[model samples]
Target: MKILFTSFLYLIGGFFTQSVAQPARHRAAQDSLTAELEALRVQGHFNGFGVAIVSGKGVLYQQGVGFADAQAGKPYDLHTVQYIASVSKTIVGLALLKAQELGKLHLDDPIDQYLPFKVRNPAFPDVPITLRHLATHTSGIRDNDFYLSKNYYLRPGLPLAGLPMTFDATQTFIPADSAVSLPEFLRNSLTPEGKWYQPKGFSARRPGELYEYSNVGASLAAYVVERACGQPFPAFTKRYLLRPLRLRDSGWSFRQIDFARYSRLYGSTTVPLPYYATTTYPDGGFISSVADLSKYLHELIRGYQGRGTVLGPASYRELFRPQLAAGNFEDRNERNPFSESYNVGILMGFGYTGFIGHTGGDPGVVALLFFDPTSGIGRILLLNTSYDDRPSEATMYQIWNTLEKYQHRVGG
Candidate 1:
């Protein structure tokens, strides 16, 4: 009995030693990665950005470098919140599936069944557009010039003259009071009978026949979910998605989160931009931090591996299943890891190299979220500054590639 007890003590000590050694190694790797990223940020053009490496189990590494508000000397850290642009569409995709699971709606059902106003392609009026068509970006809806002009509004009380105006003029901001409801905005943008309607708003292709990415189309899908579930889109997502994941810092609007942690967006490294909100909020308006998003990415990785908690294995399978063919895209971006256009699974994107994720760029924000299925590793990059020049764009890719280099080390 004395010999057996001695053996058990030896095993316990070995177990603790091994566990301690693992974290010590991880910390060393993390420190090395931090140094490299800091060097890259100093040489790069963007003012602030954050990165996260995640796997099926949990977040491996997450850090923010540079300034979230340079003028104020605020360090951009893992908790700094900012818009993630079109990556928000993935949430819409998940919500749609969750709605379907609850028997609130079906993907195959025509969108007209839920919308208050009629929506049809003027070029193909006889053909019906289904929820699946919207989810897959084959609804034949187009974001005409009016979309850029009418969709963005400055948050009330922000002075316009203080903001950078050098980007696309259509991205210019309007007064907050002028903003309309999502349903009203879609009605005006899509129906021929409304004021903002242009024939160009509906693409020449028939619904579900071509892959034309449209922000309006994505918002429309969210609206359909809103109507079918009989709840506001924001509330529905909060109840079903954000709460379950404990993403307290993520939301569609500034009102939903702690305003103090929000990062200031920039048009250029030196040009601070005023806060603006999109009327089509569902398309590109999710605000989150690397810390929160790292967890979300872990959940996604788990979902892909059939071990997710937010949705059933069957729902996740449907979410990630490739819904299009090579013929779906008239011009597929096969080489870019950031391009979600290679092929689509619901609203999710598959890159040429089998990287499943999405890319987003709004006026002053750029974001990339992708996971490699083969290794079960995922990456998230969120920048508060726009890449308006070729050098800046290259730097963006460099930062992403740098993360790729250290992912294995940090995650191991």
Candidate 2:
């Protein structure tokens, strides 16, 4: 009788264990992914990462992981800031909209009207370039890359008269063969003038022919900001976005000392020349935190339509709306697990339900901002090195999937 009773007890214990435990598939997948991510982190693979989720004017997800500076043992957190490259364009676009709202400029205003510089091309004399053209990348001008491929040389970057610099660059970019600024660069390539210049054998076509990415377009667009606001790009951004949004820890400028508190860039090892300063600061510059970015997304989502303080709702709506579709991007081929394909254009970007914020990737960082029009929701992901030193756009989309699923629970 005792033996029989013990057998029954054992059978009952097994039954309860099976009933209470998590499903095998769920446990296995979670455990596997967790182990993989942890292993990657252990090998000093993930330098730092920050993510924020917002719902109902509240932050539902503000989390950080990995190290800000592993050498000193500083940890990544909500306060940790990182360089967000091309993502700056979206912010610059907002500044332009604000300028238009203030009546200092118009999006449709031609570039020559606001800028001191003029394009040397006479073929398109009747086709004047406008802020709308630059904003939409239809200005028919080439990006800095075209100029860079021409002047690939070493030269001192001295400030030319009659130009408002977007950011400070220690070294000037060359076109692989020629050394000259945009104005000088144009003269050499198109007009057949400049020292030791050889043409790449291309001409600036008429505006609105098709989509072409241009750092020059971005810079010129920001120059419009300088023209409208009478301040450097950084100073004007602070007044319009940072101050009004109450972003306490975010700024458009950084110091050499900032490297101490700033998250170091890494690609298997720290970048030997991991500098963020560039002439295209309006295009791919600015350092910010995840927490502040979440709020920035919030402002974009509400369009300041009487819901937030950063911008007037009508003006905010204009910023988030896609102004142009410049190109189609194939995201599936990205090497990074987090890579996502986003087609970029002047004055416009999109994802789900029309225009969804923006995304950017640079030397050691890849970032994304998400906003759902149907739900008026937004989130941000800022990582030190793309997950595992690769572009992690897909990983970001997964994170978006997770948060959007949980959003309904939090009234998002």
Candidate 3:
């Protein structure tokens, strides 16, 4: 949501495969979901956890079963918050649509057209980039580079832990062992002439050429949103998106001491990093409670229903539309008649029978948000654990299909 992170060495993950074995209307459904959450907790998930499901108008099912801090034994409550991570992108997309509806900006507008700094010059013979490209991740930029430095080069033997905080997607990141300011990371994003790659190299071709996911692209879009409407990034979001939706607890802040509600980090014990002591929460800085997230999901699934003053339904639809294909992905080529495809391993919910949202992952947090255009069945699963496997995307598909298998059971 806020910080930039590097590609984590994602190995296969194992999930408990026990059947739900409960009825949606019976108390058993809630109990089954609760059991799963508790298992992750006892297994030493990040910290406290919470989840709820809303349908038609209100929450139909819900559960919260864990603590916000494991050692202090601070139990997670209805208000305990978790960093929502890349899921913030969808919120950014929604805000942009709101701006467009207000006639403040247009998606077709080029990046350079809106920025005071020399943003990506799409009109130039080779590197044509656009806001649309930025939203759908079509910009040829290989990584999320925030304020890329022209002379920046990846230093040799850069410990994966100590690299500067950045939005640059190219800057490989591992968790840190030292102190780094959030503003420093935010500042680095603006340097080095805003190139696509750094430390090694960058993509030369213009936008719209490929589906290269760029964190800098998203960060730059945030800056553009800041510039276009003459408001700071966080303020603009609060005014256009957060406040209007009544997100009382949502925010992007750097002050660390006061925001004490959080979980701990879990990495490989063999790696031997300090347990329950290390955390770098900039890339995925957006934080809110599960109740708030459920509300957000409901509004999103409803297409921000009746909020034409905010963002129209049609514009919201365009946000999930694929603008470009990020290369070096596996799903496109994997011809599994039974398996679902993916964007990286995010299990792109778009372009499938279900509509698209995104999942976010850092060391201790993994979140999945999905919306079904047909049934209006939306699911948001924010696990406190790093549950870092190919996130139950396929598993989620199984859930949807199983429900379809016995629609009479769930009565959808």
Rank candidates, TM-score, best first: 1, 2, 3
Full-model lDDT for every candidate: 0.82, 0.54, 0.49
Per-prediction TM-score to the true structure, in the order listed: 0.93, 0.70, 0.69
Cα displacement (angstroms), candidate 1, residue 289, comes to 0.8
Question: Scored by Cα lDDT, where does model 2 land?
Answer: 0.54
251-339 per-residue lDDT for model 3 (tens digits)? 76523212555544333211211222112222245777666776676666565343333457677556544443436342353333222
lDDT-better candidate, 1 vs 3: 1
Q: Model 2: runs farther than 4 Å from truth? A: 1-44, 120-123, 146-204, 256-260, 269-273, 304-308, 325-346, 352-355, 386-412
lDDT of 3 at 376: 55
In order of lDDT, best first, we have 1, 2, 3
- The clash count of every prediction, one per candidate, is 0, 30, 29
Write model 1 residue lDDT over 7-33, tens digit each, in one string: 000000000011344667677777887
Best candidate (score: TM-score): 1
Better of 2 and 3 by TM-score: 2
Residue 52 alpha-carbon offset, candidate 1, angstroms: 0.3
